[model samples]
Target: MFKKEITAGAKSKVKSSVQRGIRTKVVETYPLLAPHIDEIIPKKSQLDLLKLPDRVSLYALNNEPLFWQHMDDAIVPHLRVVHQFPHCFSRIGIDRGAIRFVLSGAALMVPGLTSAGGQLPEPEGQLKEGDVAVIMAEGKEEACMVGQLKMGTEDMKEKKKGVAIDGGHCLGDGLWKMSID
Candidate 1:
């Protein structure tokens, strides 16, 4: 949602109980991260919550941003944070042609993802509609966007020309450029 470089101000330290709750929600959402919870958010580390424009909430450790949520939506990890554990989340690859549009904060269309240049989860995989997905560009080593799927793999395969993913955090979006400090 962040299109401009917005400044995050007035951060408040999250209470231990609330921090634990955030940890629980994160672990529940990404089961693979369960084992790394302590390392990701140590009990002694100070966790602060910063409210941004458009009802977004950011959680950070020191000056490093860890994750954010838009309104009551699912928490999405920052690209820098997700880079630390690349394989933890499900992924979808878009064609090279769509990279620029995605970086510009456009909604991902099904055609770009269903084309020959794209890659989707295998039919038997558990990836479902509404799951958080890491959007990778063709031939890129790092993920370009973090978003929630609007349709399941099977459905995308059948109906291949509509919006496939909703609002996403991209490489140069305000969220990515925002300073937590």
Candidate 2:
């Protein structure tokens, strides 16, 4: 969703109760993050909220972006968060050819995931539409982007065309370049 180099509107300290709610919701959405939850968001730590354009709210700690949610939808972790706990999230890799486009903030295409250089969950049916996933590249060791799947893996295998991930935060997108300070 953070395509352009947008500006952060406000920075406010999140209330303890609200912070607890966000922490719970984040763990619920990403259960694998449970073990490192404390390290990711300490119980007594103060979290800050950065309001971005388009109703996107970014949660940060120690001037580092942690998680963000658009409206009341799923709370997606930042790429940095995913990188730190790479094994804790569902991942899909794109071909080398797709890397540039993804870094440029383009909608990920199906072929990028179905191609020989790409890699998806072993079974085409493992993932469903709207699932949040980390976008990895063919030769990269770290995730390049985080986004919600526009279509299921099964559908992508069958159709082999069209958008796979829409409006994701990429490695070089505005959000990635944005500083919490």
Report the C-alpha lDDT of model 2 over 1-181, residue by residue, as the tens digit: 7888888888999999999999898888888899999999999999999999999999999999999888887889999999899998988889999999998889999999999998888674368898899988998899999998999998888999999988888998899989767
Give the range where candidate 2 is weakest over 10 consecutive residues by summed lDDT. 119-128
- What lDDT is reached at residue 64 by model 1? 90
Local distance difference test values of all predictions, in order = 0.87, 0.90
Model 2's TM-score against the true structure: 0.96
Model 1 residue 11 distance off true place after TM-score fit, in angstroms? 0.6
Which stretches of candidate 1 lie above 4 Å from their native place? none
C-alpha lDDT of residue 162 in model 2: 95
Model 2: residue 143 alpha-carbon error in angstroms = 0.7
In model 1, the Cα lDDT at residue 101 comes to 92
